[model samples]
Target: MRSVAAVLVVLGAAGATGALAQTPAPASPVPALDERVVVTGTAAPVSAGAVGRTLAIVTADDLQRLPVASVTDALRLLPGVWVRQRGPFGSQTDISIRGASFGQTLVLIDGVRVNDPQTGHHNGDLPVALEDIARIELLAGAGSSLHGADAVGGVINIITRREASAPTARLAAGQYDLVQGAVAWRPATMGVFQGASASVDRSSGFAPARDFVHQQVRADFRFGRTTLAVSHLDKDFGAAGYYGPAPSQEWTTQTLVAARHQRPLTGAWSVTGDAWYRTHGDEFLYDPRVLGARANEHRTHVVGGGLRVGGRLSSSLRLTTGVEATGDWLRSWSLGDREEARVSGFGELEARVGRLLLYPSARVDAYTTFGSAFSPSLAVALPVRPRVKWRASVGKAFRVPTFTERFYTDPNHRANEALRPEQGWTADTGLDTYLGGTWVATVTGFVRRERDVIDWVRPDATVRWRTENIRDVRSHGFEAFARGQAGPLALGAQYTFTRVETDRLAGLSKYVDDYAPHGVGGDVSLALPWRLSTAARLEHRRPYGREAWTTVDLRVSRPIRRVTAFVEMANVGDAQYQEIRGVAMPGRWARAGITVK
Candidate 1:
């Protein structure tokens, strides 16, 4: 009743001021990447075409046509990235890029790191609501030279939606007693340009022991040159066969408090700084099917901050330098208590020479336990022709062992206290072709050589899995995209191919061999008369040591005055697959919803 009342109130308000609503931009899964500004690959802002790196951008316009309960739904349509879910609505999802392990990818909100120190499994616990996102930037290769550590694979940076669009509310209900609701307000007449959003999702279950609930509340405030944000996320879900071959349940919560500032100092120089604090709590029930099974509780606290000062040294050159500090503490029922700290200083220079652009960066990090490490990167972008650009980049990246890998243990698992850190070098080259807004295409290839790769392994299933640093591992992949619009029909397609190799321990390891070797996905949208539209997504994947599967999702929406009605069907093909062995996936799940703006 509350959800309905909220929607009705929003509808009434929207109807009373329908004429004042701003129309959104055209929807496209693949925007003009050549002109978009990306900050994920580098610490500073740079045009995607000039970054000389593989960067993927999902704009606000793209989110309009997506059937997204969480950002993972939208991310699934993109190439070079993999999103594996044990349940729907982001109950528990593992995210990786270009065949990197889940722990290798770094997740950030407005440049604040959100990667949990407890385990990479909790890295996807984003506190910000999906409706509050303005854009998502993904850098597909090494990023540690700029982002510190745990960026061995890539980086994902989510930029929030701050511009006033409209006060909106949404309510949805669907399969398995699913229910969802969200509301956002960004008043045009505000004292300090404030925005707030709250959302929730609940599902009884597709099957027994598979129920889930997710809730989020966030607020943003901007005053002069400073911005502040606060957010909370709570999720409780059944984890049937997610961790092991047993029925289980997990509950997790996170709270984020962050602040950012940017100001002009003097002359052609400027300074920017940010600080953030986050707390996460988790309770995991291991195996309910087994008598005397145990449950573990964990509480984690993190604090991070950075200060950067930069300016235009010359018309052809730009310089930026910064220092960062981060610390994390974890208290666990079984793993005991532990803490770690790191401090780093970094610098970058962006220079232009004739038709060529150069980016060079370096960073040094001092760790409380592992001593010090150095990271460096260089990149170049060149305009080869009127409608073509060539780009390339080489960088060094690293990752430290998570507390779970180093200390956590149970009947089914054992920790290796003497675990070692992992480091890798990656290089990539790509070409972009564009012509106005009608058509755009991109092709990119990358390779990574890594050492001391970490993995949990056991000689046989009869023995408990143990954490070990495999001596050597290598990976290479390529991603391509072609997108265009003609008349009322818009089409976009992307494909990615990856291969991973491990020497000595080759092919026998338990989890490191599960990367997808081939993946292809695409989307099509058609505009119909009477403010109606339809969109469809088709994706195919072939896991390295697993079977291949394909799934298709479709959505249709119609606008009536100030309200929009939508129906979405996921896994329409009913593909039988699992992100992990023994896990179950939904088949042909459907939902219908209405949005008032």
Candidate 2:
């Protein structure tokens, strides 16, 4: 309690100083929205103001200003999104959107799908370092029509840095015996742009068997209209009590090699293509200290590619078409060996008429194992006024059962091969309003109706849990957000409410029912004198079936010539809370670091 009060006092003082030192900019007579380009919400790049769906854009500047330890931490600034981490510094993380399960979200890097084919548990294992990112885009709600499977809830795209820049290095150390170092360089020569980065982070255990080591390497080259990137990530962490209540330890390594090409043809016409390969290896020990104890080893490989073309049909009409193919194979001692392949094609049209915009898209996917499925979506946007817009969308999405949910067998769990794909429909409507040139506010309401929702269930406590498909389930939610900037200060706030409806069946066990019913989050950033800056964040959550909790984080930094020093404090209240059940989070930990250019 005292710690929380102290943090509040410090923030209050900083706010006062900021207000006195800087004044707000004069408001424009007729404010106009910035013409920001976004590619994630549609088949072709479009202005953010024209997109009919809810989207959040996090820029490189935002990443540098936030005191986040990992890419997932920075995502919390957006509403209707939840990021759960078991350890610090990208050790282990899970992301969910709008009350959906973790597996329903899709992750992409440089426009290539990175979601693991075996399971969504490893989707957050991004291979690129923070310094290598150019920007991140989050599109909420079903995106299956634009991106193939695993996009039931939303999509997150992490774009890599490509601009020419000087080389920079960073080093940091802090509590829990943490040590980290990174270097990034981007240079253009002979009509070619080249970028490369490497980083490593390690920390001693805060508790027994809670240590971790993370390493990454990335390289990208661009010549003319073609670009190629390759990245590798290695992560080894003590996963004690991470899965269920067992004292488990695990190690994992991932490799990604991808290439992309784009060429502009005639007026308003372009072609793009991408190919990538990924491999992941996992080893788990039920008890590290007990020799010959139960253990599992698995290795999975995924290869995929896609080609797309877009052109204008008329002055206000555009069309895009694409084809994609993906293959997944797994070799494991416990789950045996298996393979599956899929082919998909999609098309979309964007038409504008006066003050109204319309987008319609459809996709057909043929899977070797599960036959075929078709998904479609329609979205519309209407301008209520010059500064106000209303948007609505409806879409269908699906998810195939993962290998771990089908064939794995253990003492405490069993898999079912008869499980079918989960299918659902999502609908949403929202309004976006711009107040002057510095303030923006949005409100959105959404509902999801699903059939054959997958879940693990057991008849009794003494029996092992088995995978099954539920008959029907429904979820609805709403989110509100506001953000503004004034001189050297920036402020943002978000709130969300969700409700789930399902039939109560006897002897049915449930997981992922731990989503928060209500959540409120806010952030503040101020630039003080002498190249000094400060940021603070607060998050409050009220779960459906668990205790509610609030957390606060603060950071301060100063830049001096070629060197910058910064310090961050997390869980300033020293609150004891568990994001994942039975996994205790750290409290009141402090870290400081320096960067040189």
List clash counts for every candidate, in order.
0, 0
Model 1 agreement with the true structure over 1-597: per-residue lDDT tens digits: 223323433443343233223423223212344667677877678766667667777776667775565777767756688898878888877888888899999988888888898988888888877688888888888898888888888988888887886889999999999999999998877877598999999999998889999999998888888999999999999988787666789999999999999998888888998999999999999777778877899999999899999988898788999999988999998878998899999999988765567789999999997888898987766655556666677788999999999997878789898888898988877777886674768888777888888888887777888899975877888899876678778777999999998876523465677799899988888989988999888888898868999998888999999999999998998888887556878888999999999
**In candidate 2, which residue ranges exceed 4 Å CA deviation?**
1-31, 190-193, 436-438
TM-score of each: 0.92, 0.93
Minimal lDDT window, size 10, model 2: 22-31
What are the C-alpha RMSDs, in order, of all predicted structures?
11.2, 8.6
Cα deviation in Å at residue 185, candidate 2?
1.2
Q: What Cα-based lDDT does every candidate model obtain? A: 0.82, 0.81
